[model samples]
Target: VMFFLFSLAFVQGVGSYLIQAGEDGSVTDDERDALLLWFGSVSTCMLTCFRVVTGGDDWGAYYDMLQPTGTINIIIFIFFVMFSEIALLNIVTGVFVENAMKLSQPELATLAFEQRKRDLADAASLRELFHQIDLDQSGKITAREWADIVETNEKLRYRLTVMGLDIK
Candidate 1:
């Protein structure tokens, strides 16, 4: 869907360029109508595309300008709106709802609770290991114990010093 929209954007860019290639940045009359449609239709911004389809802004002028682009382009343009805007969106929304419904509310809550319980247990186990590493029963783990128990890591040694633990 993303690829389709981007490729359509490029095609729309070329189509828009062909129509208003020689004109000024802004148009005043009929060309303005074409520009307005092109701006609203081929916009790179998703929100702008939504605005175009949802009638958040006037799209009648743009649709009218699609006339000179010929029958084939008009058909393609209509299909683009139908497929990309309507059908694809509904399919994605359906998939989301389906996935959400796969797990019941109680099951989801239990999974979350079990994860937190495991995390708390892991944290407590780490605190116990740290206490055991404090060989002298001092409140802090000294550098000597760190060296004896774990491989030397320069960053950890520096962190110990920063925490006011004397290496010696």
Candidate 2:
């Protein structure tokens, strides 16, 4: 069931991306191919993680809900959220890169590193990053460490200047 569902999601993601491209404008074959490849890669990664995390417990119920009919609403909801998120990220990345471009290399790297401080708090892949910044570990980062991490850019100074890393 999981395998079939994962396959269906991969096909659906590619189909949606192409339809989206066509709705915006004409998409070249190269663009279509690129979208398929990218979607397939990401789908594979997500499916792997899902399978690992859902090997038991409520897996049957969750898997049962993933039928094409049942999951249609969820798929649309996810598509909108993911699309808007990507668009926002593009905007933010462009703005930040442009702002950082004028700074010296040292300052630019510092700013970029600081920009990633929020990501460091991620309990998944970034746990190691948070640990490195935590200094004393204790499963949390101190205010001074957070300040050090996000002090480069004036914008993020106040946001990350807390008692400890905001781990969830």
> Pick by TM-score: which candidate is best?
1
Tell me the TM-score of each prediction against the true structure.
0.38, 0.21
Which candidate comes out best when scored by lDDT? 1
- For model 1 the local lDDT of residue 68 reads 54
lDDT of all predictions: 0.60, 0.53
Question: What lDDT is obtained when candidate 2 is compared to the true structure?
Answer: 0.53
Q: Weakest 10 consecutive residues, lDDT, candidate 1?
A: 40-49
For residue 123, model 2's alpha carbon misses the true position, in angstroms, by: 60
Model 2, 41-143: lDDT tens digits are 5565255325534342333333333222235634643453355456667989999998788553567768788768745654343455566677776888888
